[model samples]
Target chain A: MTEEAPAPEPRPAPGLPPGPFAGPAPAAAPRQHLIVVRVRLPAHLRTLVQLEKETERGPGHGTASGPGHGTGSEVTLELDSPGTQSSLLDALETRYPVLIGTIRDPRTRVRRPFIRFFACEEDLSHEPPDSDLPAPVLAGTEPFVILGAMAGG
Target chain B: MSTIRVLVGTRKGAFILNADASRKSWEVNGPFFGGWEIYHVNASPVDPSRLYASQSNGWFGQLVQRSDDGGTTWQPVGNQFPYAGVPGTHQWYDGTPHPWEFARVWHLEPSLSDPDTVYAGVEDAALFRSSDAGTTWEEVSGLRRHDSGSSWQPGAGGMCLHTIVLDPVDPERIYTAISAAGVFRSDDAGTTWKPVNRGLSSESIPAPEAEVGHCVHRIAMHPSRPDVLFMQKHWDVMRTDDCGESWREVSGDLPSDFGFTIDVHAHEPETIYVVPIKSDSEHYPPDGRLRVYRSRTGGDEWEALSDGLPQRDCYVNVLRDAMAVDSLDPCGIYFGTTGGQVYASANAGDSWAPIVRDLPAVLSVEVQTLP
Candidate 1:
């Protein structure tokens, strides 16, 4: 039996979009760095997450971190490189699983109706989930804030 | 001597009212989980110190809190409640198909024997159980998957499975009530369910005498006589002596019979209580007088108990889960109102007093009798 020659590797034509059968593009440098982002949760969520941490740490470890301890606390989340809103939230929910359906819909991953996301003094509530956060938020200079909409009352 | 602990859930948080056997003076402790709506706070019959609170918010969703040291300290447990399989559609307010979704837990019924095994009645009308002390939850899907589920619709309130009464005599028997869907019984420990709504009629629905589709607000049963059940519907007070096999209207002397809560006296199986609202359109008491009607002969007769309750100019509504009774002698009856008053009747509804009158809108009140 004659062996058929392997099909030549498909290449995209110049000035044309890659076709369905085009070969995989050359590998880019691996972006496997970890980025630590800070998240500031509203009072309700801060109390919840804080209570969970205290429980895990056992009694007396964090008893002083009560609801009136402060306005909010920064939760450091380690996310993969090029972290976006979705990535940051995925990490946040993983770290604080109790927050799964609080900030966003568990099934749809859509932000809850009365929950807003903010960073760098701008409203990012309507931004796409995969959109890159502001420079300050990504650089760890400013925390990504989750606020309960004032209108919910 | 015994103590009565009234677990009060409200629009803003959970409060625990403690009083000695006299049931007079009280000490209120809470606002726990402040800013969150506490729908129900229940203690396990097997372990009075173990309690469960259903906390939720419009913005943050639901959280189940467990307290091992009674109501002294609480820790968040598993809040994940995934419906079993593909939750099919139920009728919406506009008579359109609405997919099933998990809103907030409306009630928590801890197991009569096992502290770890607890059942949750939730909005969007479904039942869930946690076998590991609130660490995990699994849907008891058979009830929601009933043959008549598709036709179920929400009442003025969202479609919520808000009442759960475990048959103390039969460990395998369970009873759950849903808004606008009547009552259901699970004989095989929640593995399967059947609508026990026969003899129930609702004028609002197309077929008044249909097997289901009745807005049953609350159901109560004296543990000693589980076969006899008392129900407060959207418009009538009903009773069933054959385990919901048949029901008869007992709303005879109640002023309006359009109330949200009905409960049984803890010691007297024949004594029952109901708060009659003016009408469906107007949810307050009749003639602006807040009254709790007590029927000593089970039904067809009731007497208004309004000594300590507001007699006029009161416009707050009592929710379905807001009334409960303690097992103490003379049976202390407790209920909370939307006007932020938690009223307690020390002498079985002969008179009443407010345990606390300035809390948030009261959603539910549960009582635990401790030795």
Candidate 2:
């Protein structure tokens, strides 16, 4: 999974935009956005999401809520060229309809109970539930992983 | 080589901090599974060889872990679940121990009367006792039946029974502090329960009794004097002499009174220790000047004991269950931080030394001194 370290990109502060803000959404696409999924998924739910191998469609088309909606059995991840927390999670959910209560807060963007977010080599636990993730991670060129934080002792 | 064994419990898994007596340093290995947020880790006193860990796992509910050879290898007491009626789940919650209602075991204390007798504090909020180590459990009917249920309210961490204080000498006389709940006593071995909170405050608008919402964060009684007590409360640090009949603030002398966890000397009943965790600020430990404060003559005076610590901005929150004192002669005081740091104090609370750093965020810290 090594690809020359993505050209020494500048790491932006978490929840903040990269470079100067031009407007609501940046025009430039993230140069290094790539999605990698790790799963210990249960068998029963596996059949509900119709499994698909690698199919690179544009943005949210691959998310849990995408146009292909109920067709895919795999969890999908998307980075809006350069990404935002809102877009990343939304993209994944758009494609995987069964992932309703898996990630974000069921009622809010806050992380769900027993669910935690880690990136930029730090636990982004203190960040506001709705804020954008660090820009470097949005680009997704680096490794982005989403897994369950199982309970019990 | 003779070594010092350290048991660390976490919301996701448990880790073992091991090292030689030389204290040259240590090693950490874990993420031990069984589901359940492990809030308490006790290295057995009778058998330094065995370790006990309790947590909210699933319908297999409460979890119990034992390390036979000083924490190197671990075995989960899975079958003991239905016996205690605790919940156990294999899935992750908030990426932490799955918190089950009918049973969420938060505290585990080994009985001094019978080494096999172990205690588990659950969420439906009952104290279940296991006589054959963690192999089997029974709800201590006396204390469990008398619980004041109507008053119990769910805290952000969930309303539960926390600190269980066992009399090292008299097992029959035990005390447990309930969160948002009050302090309870079982003098006749949980056969009967009564509020030990005299001076402790309650949420009662008309007349506050130790009924509920007085929420005790931790209850520390002098190891030698069961009558004398000290508590790091939900909002303050307090002390009492007549067995919780009344209390007084012993925390006005610090930066801020909002913190978790407190300790005392294994030898001297008068010597005490408390970590100054930031209550009103974003940072846990004020500016990283996280010195462990000690009060030799009660909580009358507090001297900063962070001589060898970092002088930079360090906001580390030390949990109520993360600080302790080993049974060494000069009395060694030890603690770890949310920032993944562990420090040691050889001379009680005088100065400090960093034993290890850059470990995972420390959830619980337990040390065993080998004879």
**Candidate No. with top lDDT:** 1
What is the TM-score of each predicted model, taking all chains together?
0.90, 0.65
Q: What is the interface RMSD of each candidate, in Å?
A: 22.7, 14.7
- Which candidate's DockQ is highest? 1
Give the distance in Å from residue B93's predicted Cα in candidate 2 to where it truly belongs.
Answer: 20
Candidate DockQ values, in order, are: 0.24, 0.02
Q: What is the lDDT, from 0 to 100, of the residue A90 in candidate 1?
A: 93
Q: Write the per-residue lDDT of candidate 1 for residues B235-259, one digit (tens) a residue.
A: 9999999999999999997889899
Question: What is the per-residue lDDT of model 2 for residues B1-371, given as tens digits with 9 covering 90 to 100?
Answer: 45666677765567676666565477767656423356678866788777788643321234466667766676555323332333332112233444334346677777765557778776656678877777767777555445454445544455567778887667678888766567788778778888777766544323565344575777787678888888887667789887777788888687766677888788999788887776634537666677777788778677777787766687777877787777766777778777777787767767777777765566678788887
lDDT of 1 by residue, A1-153 (tens): 011123322222112211232111123413557766777776678787763333343321222222123222557777776778999899888877878889998888999877777665566788899877666665565667777766321
Candidate 1 segments exceeding 4 Å error: A1-30, A51-72
